[model samples]
Target: MYHLSSLQTKAIAFLLTLFSAGHLSGQGLKNYGNNYRDFAGKAYYFGLSFGVNRSNYQIVHSRQFIGNESIKIAESNDGPGFTVGIITNMKIGDYFDLRMIPSFSFVERNISYTGYTNLEDNMTRIESTFFEVPFQVRYKSKPYKDVKLYVVSGLKYGFDISSKSRTKRLTDQIRLSPHDFSVEAGAGIQFFLPYVIFSPELKFTQGIGNVLIYRNDLQESTVLEKILSRAFTISFHFEG
Candidate 1:
């Protein structure tokens, strides 16, 4: 068996206690507001999502260097790609819930090499696939028995699991260990069913930090290099 240190055990205990207290308090509040407890339940949802993404280099007001080369930054797209994820809902009240989603997505960018010596082409295409997790707080309008609208705000963390690239004259592939974090916001509608609930949601996500690790050199780069796209995702959820 794995043994936890005293401090670790205490931290775990504290978190569990906090979680239990919050759950119990929510239950008590629901009981007191019995008239509004119709939406209290646990649900799991899985769905397919389609979206567009763009990637770009982070531009700094100050000049930066890569292997003694000075480069000017610009943003570009590799192209549109697809996304899919599963979501779990923890109902807190008639108007509030917690949502956790895990997803796999593809991002791409066409990057142009500017102010670089011995580089042949002006641009190349880079594509990457990511595994992402998002934690969201959802607030719903009053449930009208069968239909409701909700807004979601959250943070997402993503890891770049793989990447590939191709150019007009050459194809180069590399494995990147890039990680990303973002804040997301969106709204959607839900239709309740006897055994399942269906929700279609739209979300927008923006990166919170520079996504690149190497300044301009692609050969020795391990970072994602650029953020190719801001995405608009239309996701369908089946919850039960």
Candidate 2:
């Protein structure tokens, strides 16, 4: 027999309570109206989203690091950012919807190096204003009164439109390519109100290709192999 920890037991109990209250049980007749019906006849909708994100890089070391004296180790540090976007959603079936969001993200990411002989520990910062577009497919659970749970998966393309990158004023330590491509996945709960649907979502994006632009003239660039971008975002969407 297996045993559940006290914390696990409490977590399960809490989830059970929410599930019953939100999906399984009903209230008095006075509270039993369905807000979901308001949009039953609509095939499409538009929305706006705003979110906060934490962005970082995934670094892979190169062969040069084995004997490099200037850089002992290379790592990425998290940076905070914000996003604003427009959403377009189209119903594909009773349980599925196709979505596209075009957004702008203002972010800053850091790369730090451990010092070695003839060098001191240093950190480099990369700030970007990115224009991003993502295409996603969402699957929604059956509505529970005015609420529904959904999951989404998608692909994204982003381009850094920051002035520094365009004008070549970036730090001499390292440079990143302006283009980024990623895969995304997320989940959220939707609440249907009298006039609109509001959803709060959490999403993760992972870059599929290296964003590092190798600099042959810099030692800081030689200690690393590749850099990939990653971000975790919390978004709020409002639609009618």
Candidate 3:
């Protein structure tokens, strides 16, 4: 049998919690709209979304890290990001849909090494503009008047458009792969309006592949065995 990674499991749990809370809040809403009927018959719809994110790297230490003389602790620091995307949603059933969101995202990730060669702690910052596409399966609860609660699980592929790793040799900083794949999950609330359907969402993404481009000659790269990307995002989507 296939198993879920710890990150994937946590993402699922988070979404479930989100849905539970949102469902409760939705039930308390006294005013309801009949506008949902307009979208109920649509097979597909397109929309746009804007989001903000917090992103970081998940690092795994190598065996060599123990014996290393240059560094003691290597870890990552989280940074803020922004994203804009176009959403294409296809209805599959009364409560299910398939969705694709292709976005342009800007983020910065940092790595810090403690006790670096008897000097002060060293930090490396990597900035990226990612071309990200996520394909999602959405399960929405039956409408509660004008509001509906939904959860989505998906796989995303990302390529860093701002990466200079291809054009220049990286000697001072840790190098990363320009592209990666991730597993993601999220929750959202949809509100039917007169002109558009508005949805606000929370999402988590964890990379499946190691982004570290290991260089034996570099202590920064060698101190870590693997590097995975992770992000938490908040987005607002408008659909007609």
Of the candidates shown, which would achieve the greatest lDDT relative to the real structure? 3
lDDT of 3 at 162: 73
Ranking by TM-score: 3, 2, 1
At residue 94, what lDDT does model 2 achieve?
66
Candidate 2, residues 1-240, lDDT tens digits: the string is 012123323443453445345443433322423678878668998999999988888888989988986778788888899999999999987679999999999998889988875457888888889999999998776676687767778999999988455447755668778899999877777899998999988777889999888888888888889999888788999988
lDDT of 1 at 152: 76
Scanning candidate 1 in windows of ten residues, the lowest lDDT window is: 1-10
Better of 2 and 3 by TM-score: 3
RMSD, candidate 3, Å: 4.8
Tell me the deviation in Å of residue 216 in model 2. 1.2
Q: Name the TM-score of candidate 1.
A: 0.62
lDDT of 3 by residue, 149-239 (tens): 8998899999998777633754677789888899988888899998899998888888999988988888887878999999888899999
Better of 1 and 2 by lDDT: 2
Q: How accurate locally, in lDDT, is each candidate?
A: 0.56, 0.80, 0.85
All candidates: TM-score: 0.62, 0.85, 0.88
Judged by whole-model lDDT over C-alpha atoms, candidate 2 comes out at 0.80
Off by over 4 Å in 1: 1-73, 113-121, 163-177, 216-229
Worst 10 residues of 2 by lDDT: 1-10
- What are the per-model C-alpha RMSD values against the true structure? 12.1, 6.2, 4.8
